[model samples]
Target chain A: METQLQLLNTQGFKHTIRRLCYELIENHNTFENSIIIGLQPRGVYLSSRIVKELKEITGLSNLVNGKLDTTFYRDDFRRRSNPLIPNQTEIDFIIEDKKVILIDDVLYTGRTIRAGLDAMQAFGRPKKVELLVLIDRRYSRHLPIQPDYVGRVVDTITSDSIKVKWDEIDGQDEVLMFTDNVEKI
Target chain B: MSALSVRHLLGIKEIQASDIDLIFSTANTFKEVINRPIKKTPSLRDTTIANLFFENSTRTKLSFELAEKRLSADVINFAASSSSVSKGETLTDTVNNILAMKVDMVVMRHPYAGAAKFLSRQVKATIINAGDGAHEHPTQALLDAFSIHEKLGSIKGCNIAIIGDILHSRVALSNIFCLQKLGANVMVCGPPTLLPKYINELGVRVETNLKKALEWCDVANMLRIQLERQDIKYFPSLREYIMLYGLNMPMLESLKKEILIMHPGPINRGVEITSEVADSHQSIILNQVENGVAVRMAVMYLLAGAKQ
Candidate 1:
C-alpha cells in the first residue's frame, strides 16, 4: 500500500510561480541577453508555465524560449532494461553568448541536469547557464548540481518520491509526495 | 514508454507497425540534431559498432558510418573483398573474430539473402541488416517512408506507386512491407518480366502500365534498374524500357495532379527517369539521401537502448 499527501494546492502553486518569476526578473532585468530553455518531457510543463508567468510580469512578448530533450546526452544509455525514448527538441533560436536559464519540474539525482549541460553545448556555447526547479528534493543529489532558483525545498529519503503536477498536463496544479508502505502479516 | 518490438532490425517484415512509428519519431529528433551546427551527439559514446559489408556499397555504408559517428559510436569497417572473406574464411568465423574484440553491434550487407539472420543466430551482438541479396533493405525503406511522411504530413491512405525493376530490388521489397504496414495503398509498376512472380501474394496491386500507375497514386517512388543483379534481360533494352516505363517531365505534367517523386538512388539517368524529372521540384531523392543518416541514427540509438 502507498500513502499520498498534497504538498501544494492550486492557490499555493500560483503564488510560488509568481515569486519565482519575480526572482528571475530581479536577476535578469530586461532579459534581452537571456533565454529560457525548457527541458523536455515533464520539465516542459514547468518551464512553459514559468515562461508564461515571466512574460506576463515583464510584458516581454518576444521572450526567447526553447525546449531541449537530453535523452541522447544521458550517461545511462544501454545501461537500463527499457530503452529511453526521446522527445522533440524545438530550439530554433540560437543560445550562443546568451545567458540560458534551464527550467525543469523537479530536482532529483541531478543526472538529468548534468545531461542538460552536455546537450546545451550542441546549440552553442552559452555565456552563462542557470537552472530553476519547482521542487528541490534535498539529500537526493547524485551529481554536484544545485538549482539557481528553487520554488520549494523538501527533505526526502532515498526511497521517497516527489511529483509536481501542472494544470496543463496532470489536469491539476499541485505538488504531491508519495511514500510506499509495506504491511506485515 | 516504447521500445522496439524486436531486438534486431532484420527487416521491415520482422517489426510491428509501432516500431516504424517509434523509429520515425526518433528520427525526427535526430533530424533536428543533425541540422544543428555541431551535428553530433554523445549518445553512443561507449558503444562500438562494426560495419561489415560482404557486398559492395557506397551510400548505405557511408550513411551507416556517418550515423554511427554522429552518435559518438566508435566504428570499424570491414570490406569482404579486402578481408578474410577473400581468404576463404567462413561468415561465422569472420564475425566471431570481430566479436572477440568486444564489437557491440554489427551493421551488415551481404550478397546472400538471410545472411544477417544467420549471423544473428550464430553470434550474440545486435545485427542491423543493411541489405541482403534481394531480400530486404530496411533502412532505405525507412528513410523513403519517412521522407514521404514528412512531405505529405501523413502516410495513411496515401496512394503510393513503386515504379521500375521490382524483381531484383531489395528496396522494392522492403518498401512494400514498410508502406503497407504504415497503412498506405501501394502499387508496383514495371514490365511483366521485371515484376516478381509472388509479388501479388504481398497484397500490392500490380500495374504494368507506368502512366496509369502515376495517374492512380499520390506519390511515385521510382526504383533504379539493377542491371548488375540481372543476369538475363528482363526487357528488350534500356531505350525501349525508358520509352515505356521512364518517368519524364511530360509524363509527370500529364498526371493532372502533383505527385511526389522519389528514387532509391544510383539512378539510371534516362532509363528509370529523365534528368529533368530527377532534378524537378517534385523530386525528393536528395532528401531521401539526407534522411538516410538520421533514420540510421535513430535505428542505432533505439537498438542500442534495447540491448541487454
Candidate 2:
C-alpha cells in the first residue's frame, strides 16, 4: 500500500494560478513580443490554463502560444523497454528575437526542460528563454536548471513521485504526492 | 517516458507492429525538426557512431551518416574497398578493430543476408541494419510506409503493389512484411520467373499482369530490377520485361483514380518507370527520399537510446 497526500485542492490551485499570473504581469507588463510554449503531454494543460488566466487579467489576446514536443530531444530515450509515444509540436510562428517562456506541469530532475531547450534551437535562436512550472520538486534536479516562475515547492526523496492533475485533462484540479513504489527517479 | 524496446534493429521480422508506429511517431517529430532553420539536435551528444558499409551504396550510406551528424553524434565512415578487408582481414577482425576504438554503435550494410543479425550478436555495441543483402532493408520499408501514411492519411485498407524484381529485392520482402503488419493490402507484381518461390506463404497476392496490378492498387511502388544479382536471365529480355512491367504516363493516367507512384531509387529511369511518371505530381518518390532521413534518425536514436 502506497501513501498518498493531497497538496492542493481546486480552490488553492486556482489561487496559486491567479497569484502566478499577477507575478508574470509584474515582470512582463504586456506580452506583445513574448511567446509562451508549453511542453507536450502534460505541460500543455497547465500552460493553457495559465494563458487563460493571463488573458482574463491582463487582456492580452494576441499572445503567441504553442506546444513543444520534447520526445525526440530526450536524452534517456534508449534507457527503457517500451517504445516512445510522441505528441504533436505545432509552432507555426517564429521564435527568433522573441522572449520565449517554456511551461511544464512539474519540475523534477530538470531533464525534460533540458530537452525542451535543445528542441527550441531547431526553430530559431530566441532573444531570451525562461521556464515556468506549476509544481517544483526541490533537491531532485539532475541539471542546474531553475524555473523563472513557480506555483508551489515541495521537498521530496528519491522514492517519491509528484503528480499534477488538471480539470481539462483529469476532470479534477489537484496536486498529489505518492510515496513508495516509485520506479524511475 | 516511453523508449524503444530493441537494442538492434536487424529486420522488419524482428519488430512488432507497435514498434513501427512508434518509429513513425518519432520520425514525425524529426521531420519537423529537419525543416526548421537549425536542422540539428544535441540529443546524442558525446556518443560516437561508426557507419560500416561492406557493400557499395549511395543513398543509404549518405542518409545514415547525415542522420548521425544531425543528431550531434560523432560519426566515422568505413568502406570495405578502403579498409583492411582488402588486406585479407576477416569481417570480425575489421569490426572488432573498430570497436576497440570505442565506437558506441554501428550502422552496417553488408552484401550477405543475416550479416547485421550475426554482427549484432557478436558485438557489444548497437547494430542498425541499413541493408543486409536480399533479406531486409527495414528503414526503407519504414520510410515507404510512413510516406504512404502521410499522403493517404492512414495505412490500413490501402492497396499497395510492389512491382518489379520480387525474387531478389530486400526492399520487396521488407515492404511486404511491414505493409501487411500495418493492415495494408499488399501484392507483388512482376514476371513469373522473377517472383519469389514462397511469396504466397507470406500472405501476399501475386499479380503477373502489370496493368491489372496498377489499376487495382491505391499506390504502386516500382522496384528496380537487380541486374547484378541475377546470375542468368530471369526474363526474356530488357525490352520484353519493360513492355510487360514498365510504368508509363499513359498507363498510369488510364487508372483514373490518381494512384501514387513510388520507387526505391538509383532509378533506371526508363526501365522500371519513365521519367515523366517519376517526376509527376502523383509521385511521392522524393518525399520518400526526404522521409528516409527522418526515419533513419528515429531508428538510430531509438536503438542507441536502448539499454544494454
lDDT of 2 by residue, B1-308 (tens): 35655778899988888889889988998898788777887767767999999999999988888899998899999999988899999877789999999999999999899999999888888889888988999999999999999999999999999999999999999999999999999999999999988898999989999999988999999999999899999988899988999999999888869999999897998999999999999999999989999999888877766555
Worst 10 residues of 2 chain A by lDDT: A77-86
Our tally of clashes for model 1 stands at: 0
Q: Report the error of model 1 at residue A155, Å.
A: 0.5
For model 1, the chain A TM-score is 0.95
Q: How accurate is candidate 2 locally (lDDT)?
A: 0.89
Candidate number with greatest TM-score: 1
Model 2 steric clash pairs: A78-B305, A78-B306, A82-B3
List clash counts for every candidate, in order.
0, 3
> Over the stretch B1-308, how does candidate 1's per-residue lDDT look in tens digits?
38888889999999989999999999999999999988999988888999999899999999999999999999999999889788899999999999999999999999999999999999999999999999999999999999999999999999999999999999999999999999999999999999989899999999999999999999999998888899998888888998999899988998889999999898889889999999999999999999999999999999998548
Q: Highest lDDT, which number?
A: 1
Docking class of 1: medium
lDDT of each: 0.92, 0.89
